[model samples]
Target chain A: MHHGPAAELGKDYSIEYKTRLGVILFFIYLLVYAGFVFIGVFYPDLMGITALAGLNLAFVYGMGLIVLAIIMGLVYNYFCTRHEDKMNKEAEL
Target chain B: MIYTVSPSAIVIFVIFVLSVLGLSFYFARKSKSASGYYAAGGNIHWFVNGIAFAGDYLSAASFLGICGMIAFFGYDGFLYSIGFLAGWVVALFIVAEPLKRMGKYTFADALDAKFDSRAIKLTAAISTLVVSIFYLIPQMVGAGALVTPLLGFPHWVGVVLVGSIVIFIVATAGMTSTTYVQFIKGGLLIVFSTILTIYVLNNGIKLTPNEDYHKFQTIPVVMEQDKILEIESDSYHLKTQHTEGGVTFVSLDNQGIETWWSLNRSGSEPFLEEALSIVTTADGEKLYNGAPKTDGRFYQVGHASKIIRNGQEVTETGPLGPFEFIEAIENTDVTRFLKKVFEVDGNKVTVFYQTITPGKDIMKPGLYYKLGDKGNLWSRLDFLSLMLALFLGTAALPHILIRYYTVASQRAARKSTIVAIASIGLFYILTLYMGAGAMFNGGLDMESSNMSAPLLAKTFGIVLFSIISAIAFATILGTVSGLIVASSGAVAHDLMDKYMKIKMTENQKVNAGRISAVVVGIFAIILGIIFKDQNVSFLVGLAFAIAASSNLPAILMLLFWKKTTSRGISVAIMVGMISSVLIILLSPTMYEIYGLKASDAPIPLQNPGIISIPLGFITLVLISLMTKKHRATK
Candidate 1:
């Protein structure tokens, strides 16, 4: 929300918020690696199966990951903005 | 090989193009600011950016070239997809956040962050232009390739059309419009490709007996002594040789061959009988399509089918999976399938199969080796080097690096990159299926492998074909715009302003960037026209090689090395850029693609990364050490 060094450095954020955000990112990372493992092990036959005109399931999943990444960013932005706003109001009071 | 473009295809193409243009126009107003134009004002949502990343990264080579290669060759083509996806791990884990945090506008920005030197700016700018131009050629060629089947136009016309449209896009909106275009194109590419892949799985594989298919006719003719004649047909052409045997043997043209077979028809009978042909020469030389005779007189006929597994006719018959298909070929006696060659009434033709074994000379460096050999070390290494370049080059690219600046925070950069990787990974996976489907569906073109995916779509219906082709065209436009923007920024911000010391205001710099975009656009158009026939994927590989060799070393060293100087970075960039270009120009690819004499080439082979990439790092390190004393004294 606020455009300065404080936000980038995480100077104003509480430890709990930081930890929560970190956990979320970690889960996302886990999900990605899990997807890779699943594709590698579970469905080797369908790994590169062409399901559409010129695309396969693997390609679709890869694109899906990209979409999920963007959504994650927006969610992070929204939460961060709200947290910052709440903190700012408390400080004023 | 003859194709008839239906009216539905034309209408779909028009609609797709209009939609893309409309998006560009809508975003035109937001792209006025330098930050907005070059980096989308750092405001793009991560998810949209992620898909756009996939769209921008996939290019024509990934879609067309890789698929065609796989359809023709075996598992070797899929290696490219694996290598490409593997490179993203490097982007995600190593380079993403750092790159976003370091630069503001261009790749040079990141490299020049620690040292504000003119030399670094100039060399980095030059590398950007060089790599972008190299990358542009294939996209243009791909555009031309698409137009031929979809709109029935000459290759040059497609190149010109893409050039004009891309130039207009870049000159008007720069990165902002480019990103949105890529986003839209990426989404559509994935969606439509998904639909097509499902169709393939549902239809599954059907065995068409040899007797139930139309056969291609092979014709043999004598040319002027020792002369090579390229037989041209409305759809495809056959290349054959004249041996000691008489000229009655005609080789079936594999490159131009497009086999069409129906799955089920209205007739009460389940299967229909079709003609098959074979020609045997007087020299006792057996030919499937066309090969010169050795001992016996040539005999030609139709309606013959003896499936050979490995030069022997097979007794077994059934369905096969991907691996099984190859195994079947390896285990059984499948010398050749009987096919017919069309001829006018009262015309004589010869048909034979030329035993094609891997040539010993093909192991050597040059276009002859890379395109000829299947599993040789050098060929494999050539592919490896290309994969390395593509993987490493993404994070190091000036245009791609600039995307980080569009976001608000380092975390955003990291998040956006993660998304990009996922999308990119998914899309690459799809390419394998798309490519393999085209291979078995009997839609592949041996002469031009790049058209495999689109032509495969044509088998389903015209509407699907048009939409897929149009999206592919849009894919080219999105990528070219990004490249042009990066190159133009280099020229304006790094070269003219920094190296030339023009001392221009921000507004002037922005204007200069626009002008440079026009210039780069013009340059790309010229190169695209010149290199019209080469594979788009191969061209992308060359671009990757240049990027890896020139940019990667400088960026990596600057980031981790404490004592790296401006002089070292500049020297490394110049050395890498110059050496790679010189090697590639002299390599065998030039001879093959450009028709240059191999002896005349400066380098022996196509890939220079094996030597030049390391040399770039060494140059940076050594130069940094040599210059360390001067800085210490100062």
Candidate 2:
């Protein structure tokens, strides 16, 4: 009846830092996404206004959320990987 | 709409399917072990896995359903795209690393990692099976919808064809073959969609793409002091006139053929306009456009009725930029068809009449989500609930979580997720253009929105149409195979090996998994046939809701909270799964399905995520606190 993670975290010294960074980025994206659902529900007509370029707020805001997710994902990966390398190098030394 | 089977589509479809089977057979040798059969032996490269993620996630619902919805309803379908892509953020930031570090085979492996409790393994395994089957229905149904015009086969034939192919794929090589099939499908879907979007932009907006687009034969009428008068046109003979619902309709007889036309009044002048109608006579023979279904008389619909640039009206706008196309549509008027069904003298008649709607109005939330004049508070709640479920669902999906285990390390998992987000996001952006193209071009088939993307491809030429349809079939094949693999893993690994404690060799485990794949594939084919006529996107939304409610609560709590006990995890999964399914069964949409009035349903909300998701979290917290002292003493 033994059950645990199939692979251990080993000597990954950046585990604490990575979890903190992941949680923060998750909340940041959650708020942005919640704002979209909010406007879509209550102020739907406001979305029809011309916002960016020539498209309506609905189109612009919706596209903005998608682009922001991509940016945040890449940013999360870059910083997390850098920290993992840095902390593990310090631990080895 | 009547469809003609394309010979090129059949040839292309056979080739695409054969290549997929060939990949499966080639990879079969590598998956002899249980680990290889389930998770590809943790050997897939990060980049290939990333595109495979896109291929597995896109499903037929994303390409066909979303495009059709946007084509018909404008921007509401784009809302689905935005929500679906945003869910990847959850997977990338929170779930990817820990999930890869913990699980070996299935999603249940991750949840059961914290405790060796049999209840935890059983509940998690059951939840995975439930979510996978729910997700499989839409992909299988979409396969049937595509085969009708592509290979000109019956719906059941398509269902069986896809089911049998997917079964063979999963049973032969498992995750290795599924991943490669998805990688190829994902790459082709993105490249060809970009090509189709270019064609749409190149053609631009046309008031009449063809000669007969606006030629519905409008004739002016003469009246003598509101008394009997002779019509001005000698071509058509007015046979009979009737008024229903305060609108007048005249039955016209032309060369021994009779059809219905609506009367329109322009200020003080009256005119007769020909309309499209499908009639089922008392003898049970169906007619399309006042002719038999095989007559090839049914017309292709949806076009820009009016095009404008700046402040002036124009006939066409040539080769506009991406942003310019949206601006042009904003100032133009498009012809959208609306349907009404009525019975006259035991004969059922459905008429599709044209309505000229402003582009500004069409590009808003009113069409599908309905926060406009026709919508009330409940509609807004339904919209919010669906968006919430879609956002939370992706990371919780069993099939998606298992992909995190296929890579070598947690870092590869994170990188692959980013790749998925980028590719899937770009494809979604292309969907907005393809949808608008179908909306303005004469490519819409009113019967099924799932046909919109392929039908839009047909307007370019048969070669593009054949290739796009084959890619769409591959899209379905890739997704269905993934779902079957996930389900088989749940059955053989979680349910049997872990819970039942069936002492078996590695060979026996792989054999059991292959048998499970066959069973699950057959079950999916049956459900696909039963739900053949259901909307593809709507079913996908339900799958998302169920996953978000049932699986997300337990996974989040197990990872982040110290008080999450095995009892809490098992009970919460059941409560979440049962309550969500119950609420859906009692929702207004189900009431309509039962042939009852929507308002007569007890629950007002169409989506149960707003309530059921919170309920799951609450149940887990209460149960864990109650069992805390008991567990400590034990």
Candidate 3:
């Protein structure tokens, strides 16, 4: 039937590698995100610290999490695209 | 109070609605098959679908409710904003591409991919409906709140109006029309909100109270001698005055004592004054309860009571930078208005008073949580649970997940989600400014926080008010249409086509979906009117809780864990959905809804994600392990 490489599900070498990268990025994002939440809940007074330009720590940190999501998304996309190209090239070879 | 019905607003609103209806009608012809109806034939441009993602997601809860919370309370509302955006992390990294690769049309298609079990289909369909309806109520409520001020229409008028229109949109051409509606509204919402934020910055923070504010706040009282001589405030003369104890005399409004009145009565129990109220009727008549009429409709509510510019209290600070605005506001005193509704002189009157709070206090958390109350522990827990629900729910919502199928491939799905995140994140950042702008400006309404953003625009001009309100209405239509599409797809695609194996031609399938959309749209309208008073953001939090608890565990297990059985998936779905709803229903907040004391409720916390989500995961793992051997033999 000629099911493609992407359809192999959990066993294809390239797909497994991409999945690993996704897991890593997910953890990195979660660690910072959860830290911001915990700090907000437990040490709320810390959020009051005007760490930058009259903006409180909470303000800066909350914004940091949002920006981080975009950055992580870009990095994942770049590497996955590169890897997909490589796998396709190898298949042709 | 800043709201007034504008001819221009009515014009813009009609134009906006007619164009949306036009788009839906055009798409109706393009939706030829079941696939075309359900997913726009999976040929949508990734970029278009990406913006459409933003349109589908930024519901009334995000726009009106979050903005209102920030305006009325402060930074706590941004907590919801951040939590909601952070959820895309899960969606992008894990769910997006894989979900696209697996699912054909409905979300149930993805979950039922491996086992192809009717149990999974039925449970998933039921879960989709419950979550969709839960989410729909808030959007409808937000629509109702907007209608009253925009057109002087009653709440039900708005509810039924939006309900009927959205049903028509969905029934005509399911996803094609739904996507276009979302895309146009999504793009317009961001653009208009940005313009509003920019206008707020240019205006800066003005300390000018309404002209009638002083007259209403300060009542003149005349005292003749040491004996009870005379008292007149709000037209009530001295009934009788006496010195009860060793107290000599006190003056109200001593320029320092923080309260509204100063009396020169002797004793711990100084003579109490008659209550004053200010009510604005539905007919634009402003009645100072027990007093004369004031032509003003809305007095400024949340504003910097005192602004210190260059070490002196200033009348106005004009044109500050975005960073400078927040800093200057933090250094000032803000007047937070409180409203009280009571029966007086055989009439229902509402009174609003300004409480002076430090600006630093306004810019921080703990305002919304009420940490000082007897239910302090529960309130804190509930707060955490809400954040969790919002964070998890983004990856779990059926409408959101189904968007992946509208695009071409796994790669397209991933790229489109990233695009959605960028635009949506920028919009959320703008929300903080918009919320603060309304708060510091005089357009806040304590009784209806949902009016904050639109009311703020009215303060700028009637034209901007009309346009912003019209866009806000479109935002409701877009989100509701998307939710209805997802629900109808679940019913027709999963329940009818797959589970029941009802062999219908492409034409028949589209018909079934149209029927489902009509039924669900009506249900949404009724629920919306019933929950008219709840803050839309809070209702959205409950919806997130249900999605996080029910759908997330099953989807995550199915994709990653090979041992996950169909039985486990069904059990987990039922448990996650039912337990979350049951807990939410029994919580103190629901008890209050039932007209019972919060203290008398069975549970303390208002949020259900903390318990129900973990139970979903635990059930999935345990049930999967037990059913593994049986599945292997089969």
What interface RMSD does each of the candidate structures achieve?
A: 10.5, 2.1, 4.1
How accurate locally, in lDDT, is each candidate?
Answer: 0.63, 0.86, 0.81
User: Which segments of candidate 3 are over 4 A away from where they belong?
Assistant: A1-13, B1-3, B209-216, B220-300, B339-352, B371-375, B629-634
Clashing pairs in 3: B247-B266, B247-B267, B250-B263, B250-B264, B251-B262, B252-B261, B252-B262, B252-B263
What docking class should model 3 receive? acceptable
> How many Å off is the CA of A17 in candidate 2?
1.6
Provide the lowest-lDDT 10-residue window in model 2 chain B.
Answer: B223-232
Best by lDDT: 2
Model 2 spans with C-alpha error above 4 angstroms? A1-10, B211-214, B219-273, B372-374, B629-634
| Candidate 3 DockQ vs. native | 0.38
- Residues B536-594 of candidate 2 have per-residue lDDT tens digits of 87888888889988999988888788888889988999999888889888998788878
Tens digit per residue, CA lDDT, model 1, B1-634: 2356678878888887777677778888777666777777777777777777777887888888877765554334654665566555545545555566556678887777666777887889999888888888888889888887788787788888888888778777778888888888888888888887776554433333223233434333224444435443444443332232322222334454311211112244322121122343354443422333222112211111233444555443355443333333223221122222333223333223322212111111121224322335555456546645765666566666666666766556656676776666666666756765664455554336788788778767777888888888888888888888888888987788777888776677778888998888887777877887687777777887888889989877875677788898889999998988888887887876665565566655567777788889999999999898422111
Q: Give lDDT tens digits, candidate 3, residues B1-634.
A: 3345677888899999899999989999999787788888888888899899999999999899999999988888988989999999899988887788778777888888777778998999999999999999999999999988788788899999999999999999899999999999999999999999999899888776344333334343444455545444444443322232332222232222112222424344335332234544455555543233333334445667689877888988889888888887787888776555444334344545455677777776767864433235777788789889999999999999888889877778888999899889989988888999898777677668999999888878888989989989999999999899999988988889888889888899999999999999999999999898899999999999999999999988887888888988899999999999999899887887888888898988788999999999999989989888524222
lDDT of 1 by residue, A1-93 (tens): 111111132234433453366446646644674564344333434545554443445444544444554455446546655776687578778
TM per candidate: 0.72, 0.95, 0.89
How much native contact recovery, as a fraction, does model 3 achieve?
0.33
TM-score of chain B of 3: 0.89
Off by over 4 Å in 1: A1-93, B209-213, B216-241, B244-377, B597-602, B629-634
Report lDDT (Cα) of residue B297, candidate 3.
34
lDDT (Cα, 0-100) at B46 in candidate 1: 75
